[model samples]
Target: MFGDVMGMMGKIKETQQKIEETKQRLDTVLIDEQSNDGLLKVTLTANRTIKNVSVDDSLLEDKEQLEDYLVLVLNKAIEKATAVSEAELSAVAKDGMPNIPGLDMFS
Candidate 1:
């Protein structure tokens, strides 16, 4: 019985290690997504930090349209970044990771 317990404990440790490694790997992996129109765009890090933005010549032709384009692109960028992040993190949760509350920690 003691030997069996030790083996089980070892497996748990290994799993925890895998989760940590996976998180680290995810932190290193980066993905950039943008909308069809370049009027506005954002660059995000693997950890979801806005890195940069771009504007298009056509959108700037109209001040009002430029503002709308900026808002639209921001929303689209956020949506895309979140989707990609969630998909990647799903692997972490599926493997039995703990949830970080308030982060919308999803599976």
Candidate 2:
């Protein structure tokens, strides 16, 4: 019984390490989004760090419109990045998890 517990503990530690590695990898995974009119564009990492933003001259003419565009495009980018981050992290965690009876958290 102690052996099993020790093995499980090792597996959990391995999983935690993998999770951290995956998070670092995700920082390189980029998600791009643009306004429907293509006037505003954004690029961000799966970690939700903004990398770049491009705004059209027309958008610059209207402060309110630019803000609206930024909101919409940034939200879309964040959503995509969040989805990718979650999927990658979940896969790593689920794959690393030891099969323990009565713990079907991943399922």
| TM-score leader | 2
- Report lDDT (Cα) of residue 33, candidate 2: 95
In candidate 1, which residue ranges exceed 4 Å CA deviation?
A: 1-37, 97-107
What's the CA RMSD for each of the models?
6.2, 0.6
TM-score of each: 0.55, 0.98
lDDT of 2 by residue, 1-107 (tens): 99999999999999999999999999999999999999999999999999999999988899999998999999999999999999999999899999998998997
- TM-score of candidate 1 on Cα atoms, chains taken together: 0.55
Worst 10 residues of 1 by lDDT: 98-107
lDDT of 1 by residue, 1-107 (tens): 68776775676576677767766675665555555754466776556667777777776789998787767766766676667666766665555533334545443
Q: What does the lDDT read for residue 17 in candidate 2?
A: 98
Cα shift from native, residue 63, model 1 (Å): 2.3
Tell me how far the alpha carbon of residue 68 in candidate 2 is from the true structure, in angstroms, after superposition. Answer: 0.5
Candidate 1, pairs of clashing residues: none
Q: Against the true structure, candidate 2 has what lDDT?
A: 0.95
